[model samples]
Target: MIDDELRARLESLGGLDAGPGSLAGVVVIDVTRVVAGPYCSMILADLGATVIKVEHPDDPDYTRTFPPMLERDGADAFSGFFAQYNRNKLGVTLNLRHPEGKVALERLVAQADVLVENFRPGTMDRLGLGHERLREVNPRLVYAALSGYGQSGPYRGRPAYDNSAQATGGLWSMNGPAGGPPTRVGTIIGDLAASLYGVIGVLAAVRHAERTGEGQLVDVSQQDSVLTLTENAVVSYTTEGIVPEPLGNQHPFVRPYELFACQDGFVFFGGYTDKFWKISCEIFGAPGEFDDNPDLQTMGARFDDAVYAERVKPMVERWFSGRTKAELEALAGDLVPLSGVKDIAEVVADPQIAARDMVVDAEYAGYGSLRTFGSPVKLDRTPPRARGIAPDTGEHTAAIFRDLLGYTPEEIEELRAAGTI
Candidate 1:
């Protein structure tokens, strides 16, 4: 039960009221920690859904203290990564190993339209929050499971991270420069890709449930999601019996599709088509060489001739060496596809990102001015925005129990004293 003062504060802040003309009625119970699952829930919360993030009472989310963690009020403040992924969420803590905690969670689930979890395959079932158990309590609930592998796969029980998934899914095998060792991408591509796929599956399940009044499980595997990005490599191995190797920044099958050095940094150039290639050659003042070199005439020939890339690199470098990033961009105009490599600072300061509202400020009581990435999707009629900062652990526990579960103050106090929350 919420204290009278807290209840008054919540009421004044409009407790459980749907945002105007929004998809605000739906509730999302996020029983996930770390990047992938929390990121998915954040997206839903941005879309006006009420997302309640459940954290472990004892351990909490380790990411809360990840590097770039701020220090505030004597405790290690929330990491920027954690805050970014968990924005617009209400947070609560529960020791799910306790029977009372599980009972409270079931009560919460009964009111939720969706439940997302990213534990290893059998963890939820062992916790008695499996799909069958959940659906029995609320048949309309869409259960989305995000894991390293699909529920029934041979590797389902194996531990995985972004790098592990990238390697196992054949993504790392086809990355890096030609003749170099397989290199993993700098970003957590596998985890993020899986999260986005999980989002799609959850929404699809929601739509189906709305139509048929039945809910089902949506399973998203990081390896499977990353595999979608390795389309041609998989095809090459299967259809042509070719073992694809890393081509660095270059396309394995397309010539002149790699990054070229510029005056300051690098510029990626891809002229796959004959027309684009002609334009690129003309821009570089190498039309004669472009016309005469038989190896450079076709993508296939250029790919086959290792000497072709070596010959063209110097010319391309010279052309870019004389031009600033802006000048080169202006010269290329709309005809040539080129982009300057942007570091994190450049990306953060980019006008296009600001104009598109890809960053927003959320208030953290302990930490002022929490700036983080915003929702990318733009809905015409129901645009999404960051609602609030991530809550402190168990911040909304008593309030939610009182308002949604109708628990009494005496009961909540007993649970708290018993260390159930």
Candidate 2:
């Protein structure tokens, strides 16, 4: 039964609508935090699912206190970064380590359509809340697990972060400059990629359940997910017996496919096809150069010619140096693809981002209004809204217990005293 306190909390967020379903009836139990799992669940919530995020009462998500903490309107200021990833979901605190907490969780699972957890391999089983256990209670529950390594590998129990996954998954080796040490990507690429894959798996499972009334387990590994993004690098090494290293910003087998300096900053230029290369030469008034040397005449030949790179570098630099990034972009137009490398600030303030409503206003009761990234996906009939500020630890304890879980005032106090809610 839904507790009155929980119901009150939901009411504060505009009570859950129970009408004809359109993802509106789906309930997502979010037992994961940090980047990947939270990101995946947020996508589900954006699509109109009711997501209840369960965090530990005492050791609430560490992200809540991440840098740039603000003190606002009587409540502790939440980290902006934390708020960004956690929007569009309801927050509740539960000490899953306790028996009472476990019982409460079972209650939640009974009504949930999907449950996402990112605990290490075997952790859920240890808690008796693994996929098999949950399926026993709710046969139609889609239990999705996200981990660093897979559930049954030799490395299954090993802990991993984004950098570790990048290293182990072969992404770092092919990322940086040719002579530089293997470098992890600037962002949590592995985590984000894994989250996306998890979402795909969950959605697929959800559809299958809707059709056949059968739910299944979704096991996603960050290592495995990131390997997919490595593309041909893995295959090249396996098929050709060549261990690939970083090629800097250049494509391993493509000539003129790298970033070049202009008079101002930098511009990435790639003319992959022979026809495009011919056009590039013509644009730079170097058509004769494309025709003269047999090695420079074809794509494959140009790719293998180290000396040819030196010969062409100066010309490429000179042509780019004469124009501003905007001018160069205009000159290339649809004929050639060119982009000005932008930093985060520039990306945030970009006209395209603004026009697409990629940044939105989120109202925190204490903070007034805060800006965060809007949903990246668009739905014709169900657009997502930034619902509310991330809840303070245990802020909704009384509300969730009294409203949604149907607990009485006495029971709430008893649980609080017992340190179980």
Model 2 error, position 395 (Å): 3.7
Per-residue lDDT value at 411 in model 2: 83
Regions of candidate 2 where Cα sits further than 4 Å from its true position = 1-22, 286-297, 386-388
- Estimate TM-scores for all models: 0.91, 0.90
On the 0 to 100 scale, the lDDT of residue 74 in model 1 is: 69
**RMSD score of candidate 1 (Å):** 3.7
For every candidate in turn, the CA RMSD to the true structure comes to 3.7, 3.3
* Cα error of candidate 1 at position 180, Å: 2.2
Cα lDDT for residue 144, model 1?
A: 93
Error of model 2, residue 246, in angstroms: 1.2
Which has the greatest TM-score? 1
- The RMSD (Cα, Å) of candidate 2 is 3.3
Q: How do the residues 111-131 of candidate 2 rate in per-residue lDDT, one tens digit apiece?
A: 788999998989989988899
Overall lDDT per candidate, in order of appearance = 0.79, 0.78
Q: Mind sharing the TM-score for model 1? A: 0.91
